[model samples]
Target: MSKTTIIDKEAARQIREGMKADCTKCFSLCCTALNIVASSDFSINKPAGTPCLNLQPNYSCQIHSQLRDKGFKGCTVFDCLGAGQVVSQVTFKGQSWRGNPEIGKKMFQVFPIMEQLHEMIAYVSEALSYEIPEDIADKLSIQLKKLQYLTELDADDLLALDLIMYRFSLNELLTIASNFVREKAISKLPGNRNIKDFDHARVDWIGKKLEGKDLRASDFRGAYLIASDMRNSDLREVNFIGADLRDVNLGGADLSTSMFLTQMQINSAKGNEMTRLPIYIQKPSHW
Candidate 1:
């Protein structure tokens, strides 16, 4: 991995664009297929395949504008990665589950499968965008195509697919991609900040107080940084692919150059307007 091949900035933009949720084009599959629990983030316990209480007749959330204030903050953080619309419009041909009860259960089952495929596409796209060796990039591209192809399958085919196998293959590619980006980040750092200081594979900084630390070019792939204090941290070129960011403090943290930090992760974390985010994520009004 070389600095010249660190195309994550552009690659992140492309993946985010492709995965951006378009509620208008979707049948609100997430509000129906997924289960919700009563917690700090949710207001009630909803079973799988059951429509949410706040779901409207038009397949939209009635309280979409006030989800957080109404104790549905979890809803705000969750992303279907464009699978909701793909399942609703593409797989089902715009035939919603509302009037068709027979296909409703099937749709519920397929929605999650499609969501998983879309999630893989998101990560695989990022992996392909990294600056790795040509052989690895070619392999990643093949995996990416396979994941994308799965998203285009019909309900029965999608349900019959072996997700565990696909996941295993994708995980192998993701490991390669994660390592490539992390090594590239480390190469850009000064001599004193060596690679040994940071955890590359699965850094465990959970609940650690790392405020204002110089964490430039650190590998945070699948790192557990939940509830960690990272305020004003120098996170330039840090690879954040698959990192747990829930409740992670990012006040004044310079993440403008961070790699693979998605909008969903940013929304879940505790950040102020002063937090330096990548160009793709808008500054939340709550911040």
Candidate 2:
């Protein structure tokens, strides 16, 4: 196959949804700096900090299409917060990387911090709008502004940023963020809270981690589980209604006669013909 592949419009659109201009500033740097090891989803010979042989000059992937076949599943999981462009557009003024080894090294060092700032931005932005009480809105807003400032920094400024930036009295803001996550999601998720009022009769676990845990016959209704890992766990007849299960992992789990486990969910998760049928699943193709 060729060194690179073209990203289709659908892929580009999906990337753009989570990608903000500020966030993408970091991704470009990450792409250039980080080395991804070859695995089941990416090729077998690569390392961090070394540019991927498949990367085009403009930071686009060469073998974008055959990623899985090339063993680059890790690439799909990465979310750069526009750190690339930040380094390129803000720090170096776009005059150095290709010809200057010293500048290239500095850009590589900046990737991690910008990525962290971008992640914090996502969380802070989400918290700002999640039902925070009016009084605490100002507190959250202040913290949000601080975090936004952290995103615009060059490598040196980011490295020098102190922990004091996160030292804010955000008790109410935290609660609002937590509750928003809980109410919109199932009571049980990666970050679970066993509140007395939680109605476990029906729950969803989209993109959660219950790996090697006991959750047999759990009622799940109106859940949005996208990429949860339930490896080698108990799941006999678990109800699943209105769940957004995109790429859930149910390897070595059981779901016999599970009510409401839809075909889409079944196809998305792991299952075999010998695996207890979920009515919706016609024997899986891989297993």
Candidate 3:
């Protein structure tokens, strides 16, 4: 447990804003650190720690505008949640791996760790935005402080962290907060006394046709929703933490109040202009 800092709504908003990726401040760490398998998503198979073929000397993607058209759809969906800039500027002190080849390996390793930490911070910050019980809010605040502190640590310390354990602990609080919010939403639904029916956490719905369904306040945590057709569905207040939304059709769906739905998830899915999204998430240009 870390020293708890009281995070008001405004502070939570600021924390989330700081977690957005700014490529100009980054050194194209994702292009080098992550492995790309040759699937429909990627044009080529690239090993970890190796730079992508499209990476330029200035760390900009050569095929940036044509990534999807150039058979590199995977690159389009990946979002580091501002971890690249934090690693490049703060962790490595504004050093580029290209300039200092010796730091490349370690910097690559640290990037993923920082990405996960930032994601956890984003989720906690989102939880704090809701009207949860004070006890849960206090615990979430402590966890947020701990995660923020971890991000500022040296590379070795970050590599030594047990992220699985941390994720498990943080997920407990997130689950509670999600349940609190969903329950309130469910209570307002017409004839919505069957609470157990909405507990669809971790269900396998891959490629299922769920068009125009009333799935409001449902818990889809860790669910595999790949290629599922959820067009025009009522997904308001649904908990989507860790749900695989790849290629899911959300055309005309209303997710304006969805919980824990990250930008990465939304980017991977197919949405139309009519699809209502949460205020924090931006609609993908491809949609």
Candidate 4:
């Protein structure tokens, strides 16, 4: 397998489009495959492989419109990144677990693996969206193809995948891309004297008040930012991969160019109409 494949802008866009969830094409896999713990996000505890009580026979959520109001905020935050549709339509050849009782267990098992592969693909696709160096773009394109190939594997092959190792390798590439963009953005900052002060990778900022700060191009990977007040922050070009954004305030913040920000992360946080998000991420309806 080649380690470098050039993906054009249109191809990259299509790859990203494929990663967005389309619930109409899915079999409500998340409702059945995931174990829900009773928390503020979920109204009740449901065992894995057991369909939620609100799941209709047609595989649609009975209370889809009222998920958040009904205390099913977790459901609203969950995104399969188009994994469910791929597993249902491609992997299993349009077979429904409900119709084919024998495939139910295996289908449930494959969904999560497919979700992870799709996620890696989505991130790599996003990295490729940026105007990075040629070497990094080639490497990201290669990783994107590799992850997409993994999603096409059989259920057993997906189950056998060493996701930890793949994630470790992919994270290195993503970090390199992130640093390149962040450094470039920081260099262009006016006065340009406080460059060394922006490195906040993996820091603890839980419940901290940081309202209206010029936080452009900061490295915040794996940071604990739960419940932080980050309203009106200039978050452009900042890296937020693996950052715990639950309950964080993003009201009036500009995250238009934030690196590796996912729909799930944005959905978990508190944001309003004024929060500027990346073009790919939709503002949460509840916001």
- Highest-scoring model, lDDT: 3
List where candidate 3 sits over 4 angstroms from the true fold. 1-5
Ranked by lDDT, the better of candidates 2 and 3 is: 3
lDDT of 2 at 118: 54
Q: Tens-digit lDDT track for model 3 on 1-287?
A: 32345687788877776678999999899999998899999989999999999999989999999999999998889998999999999999988899677799899999999999999999999999889988888899989989999999998998899999999999889999999998898889998376677988889999999999999999999999999999999999899999999999999999999989888999999999999998788899889
lDDT by residue (143-244, candidate 4, tens digit) is 887887888888889889999999988988898888888878877988745546787878999999999999999989889999999999999999998899
State in Å the error of residue 239, model 4: 0.5
TM-score of each: 0.88, 0.56, 0.96, 0.95
Give all candidates' CA lDDT scores: 0.80, 0.55, 0.92, 0.87
Worst 10 residues of 3 by lDDT: 1-10
* Per-structure clash totals for the candidates: 0, 34, 0, 0
Q: Candidate 1: lDDT over CA atoms? A: 0.80
Instruction: Single out the weakest 10-residue window by summed lDDT for candidate 1.
Output: 1-10
Worst 10 residues of 2 by lDDT: 1-10
